[model samples]
Target chain A: MSHPVACCYLKTGRALMSTQRPDARQLPSRRIADDLRQAIETGELLPGARLPSERELAGQYGTARNTAREAIRLLTDEGLVIPEHGRGVFVRRESPLIRLGNDRYSHKYRESGLSPFLLECAKQGKTGRFEVLSIDQAQPSAEVARHLRLPMSEPSVLVRENVFYADQDPVHRVTTYIPWTIAEGTGLLNPEVGHPYGIHGILEERGHTMTRLRESVSARMPKPEETRYLHLPPAVPVLDVLHLSIDQDHNPYELTRFVMRADLTGLLYDTPIE
Target chain B: MSHPVACCYLKTGRALMSTQRPDARQLPSRRIADDLRQAIETGELLPGARLPSERELAGQYGTARNTAREAIRLLTDEGLVIPEHGRGVFVRRESPLIRLGNDRYSHKYRESGLSPFLLECAKQGKTGRFEVLSIDQAQPSAEVARHLRLPMSEPSVLVRENVFYADQDPVHRVTTYIPWTIAEGTGLLNPEVGHPYGIHGILEERGHTMTRLRESVSARMPKPEETRYLHLPPAVPVLDVLHLSIDQDHNPYELTRFVMRADLTGLLYDTPIE
Candidate 1:
């Protein structure tokens, strides 16, 4: 259930070398990358293991040090390695991936008063922390307005923006927009909200029980602000997951927008069919 | 229902500018990009609308033409704009987003012999097409091995690889691996298996009905092979959706790996809560 990232990475092992030789024009760095990549896939080079220095790689392969460095760069772009300025290159650690399922939003978790992030982190044997970047009364974006079924000019939202971190690594930055009507007279407008249960519990307690959730998932290059805050490498994209929470009557309530680091995360969803 | 991509893009309207003034040190291009992004978000610059030429932008902003070009480049990188070689830059159009829920695999769809992809595309009002890339019995990848619960030592799979297109645009490339045991007794080995319904229909008719599906989603830069086959621009990310199909008895049967264009596709999953 955990380590989804590792499982996905292992899928690349499908690239088995064929008996046929490579094209004569293939770059040396590309060939080097393929062999190193194969080693990583087969577990010959485990995560957290350091690769040989450029000089060593060049000496062994009889190629330019820059060419060896380029091979390492290729692996880094593939999310298989990370280069620390002066410390050399090391295999990237595959974090315990995010496994989001139907159960996380259960009344059980709500009753026990634990934020989903906190519960998920604890379940994965990691400490979770969230910082409230800001909380304010603001104009709802057009999508939020649509979800809340309000004309854009007339609606406002209680925007609670926060970033969730597992230990020291910032994993996701979320902005949850709650309509003024649904948020009014509830603790949701407060920056602190419902301590243990979070806003969902508060919403449920207020008679607006969530009956359904709609989520749309996409990925894109991160914005400059996100690049700085998320510490994402140049090549890794960001996952944009938007969630819409609806009450028992299917009335929409909160819309949370998540900008997550793609390299460090994988979303797991399961559904039963007839 | 048809274009999930367009709906997701409409979501960018979530950014409502703040009243506070920004600090003066922001880069000129960054500032230019933000304002243009806001215009796009608010619908002032609609999709497919051509952006001002670099010369016009520079003249209007009293900045270098190169600075203006950089700003447009920023938008293109964000997927907000597309630059067609000599045609200049224009707002990117939204394609039909893939809103895949649990229903596409229901008994009704299977009985009606509707392939999930066709049903999905039709519901969105988009024409769908599939091109078979290759069909062969081959060694299953480790992920497939794990999904089918077979030892790495033995077991092969009937691999069916295909590319899907929406209208004229290549949207997704899918490779499905079925264990030899499950595939041997069915028509799934054929390049064209249970047409109109695909493999699931044949499996259902054979009483190996799929009862559940588990999906994992991740994103990264596309491989050179994928870039060439999928016709993906260098900046766009690819969504890697790996799915496992399980029968009523909870035994895994099929493993399908999809490499979809992230910019043109979004997966919509909805579920009910107690």
Candidate 2:
């Protein structure tokens, strides 16, 4: 639990004095990492640029090889660099960011024969497609049931899971849950739900037009399953978005969760002050 | 760059067979970390629960002490656990999550005698306050200039930097940029702008009543300064929000950037579809 650098500071009686000036008290490795991070942030080092080898860094910083290695490890853990076997470490090259705005769900775009994700990709000159992972009936979890306003006695809800890809790279793992009364004996169960309007269109035709939406957004390190599915890089987190669709009568009809790679996604919200 | 365990698998000729099943091919430390992560996620190990000591874990798993340490390090890096000085490692106990929804900006709440951050904190029974870091005139960064439609000839904008606290813990570091044309002689440049409406009210009186807003949200690791300001734990990312305010005449007036701790904030957006 003790850091050698901290011990050195304490022995010198500098730790107490450095409390008023924290930057003066930082470990050598951390200072080196901070300088490299600033270089990356300011575009002094471009993406795919190779960083100096550990030995070179050690020579430049007048530190031990282990100290240099720790600096590089810090950048790797920040998702700013990737080290290749037998090759040098290079700055990470990020995919084009996809911005999801509230207008993506506007009904006006529904007639364009494209789902929201596809439409967004088209606008950005990126190809988008989704693979239907599963469509089945399952008992809704407590959260899902509450969001959909289904009673505990309800038998089951329809679950449709899909992995969406942008430019052939997996970006989102979406799982949608629909009430049994609304999804039973419909095209909702099919893997191929015709596009343009997609599932929302089908729901609208069934007297449940989505008039509103509620989205809760948070971020965290990706789970192992998410890391595997999204092919996430080291230290990359995922944006967890929980979405709810409500009808004109205030009925919450559907609940969907989107797990998106944080490195390649941004969320935008534009609304009135009222 | 070579993993000893992977080398062992290759030596035993099990590498190829295990490729089809990733879970079966995981390194022992990773498997152990995943098991602990699931226990945390499923609430089996509640927040503040102490994990088994490293020696106990090593004995139980029949592994080396270093392997047990690595497993614990993985959990620590994921922000799931914290190692205390002299005490055993314990699960991280998060503060109550503050949900920031669009309604927080509704004009009706402007009369509540509290800023949005303070209002939200009050609702959650937490005290919120802010300390003005600085107020000065600075040339707008390119991005800020573009957002405010300030021509290159424009000299500078009023910059107000503040750090907001929730229950005495710094949660947001906000930097607001206002066009000099609107803030030249206004109270916006003053550290104390009074309560309730605050700077916004002064802008409204100057015929810049904000009617619309656009927020761009992304997540990434905290910078060194942010890590210090927010007192963030290791491996915890932060939410970066860029906010632009527009008046009824569609004039973009204010630009503010909010750097918030991901562990303590959740952004909610509830809006009607067009």
i-RMS values of the candidates, in order? 2.0, 1.2
Off by over 4 Å in 2: A1-28, A38-44, A55-66, A94-96, A194-197, B1-26, B38-44, B55-64, B194-197
In candidate 1, stretches whose alpha carbon ends up further than 4 angstroms from where it belongs are A1-77, A80-83, A86-91, A111-116, A151-154, A194-197, B1-96, B111-116, B119-126, B151-154, B194-197
Cα-based TM-score, every candidate: 0.75, 0.87
In the order shown, the candidates' DockQ scores are 0.48, 0.65
The Cα local distance difference test for each model comes to 0.75, 0.81
Candidate 2 residue pairs in backbone clash: A113-A196, A114-A196
User: Candidate 2 at B161: error in angstroms?
Assistant: 1.1
Highest DockQ model number: 2
Tens-place lDDT digits, model 2, residues B1-274: 1122232334443443445564463676776687788889999899999988887776666557777788998888778899886799999997767777777667777777766677778888999888899889999888899988998888589988888888978888889998998998888877888522478889988899888889998888886678899997887788888988889999999888988888887788888887
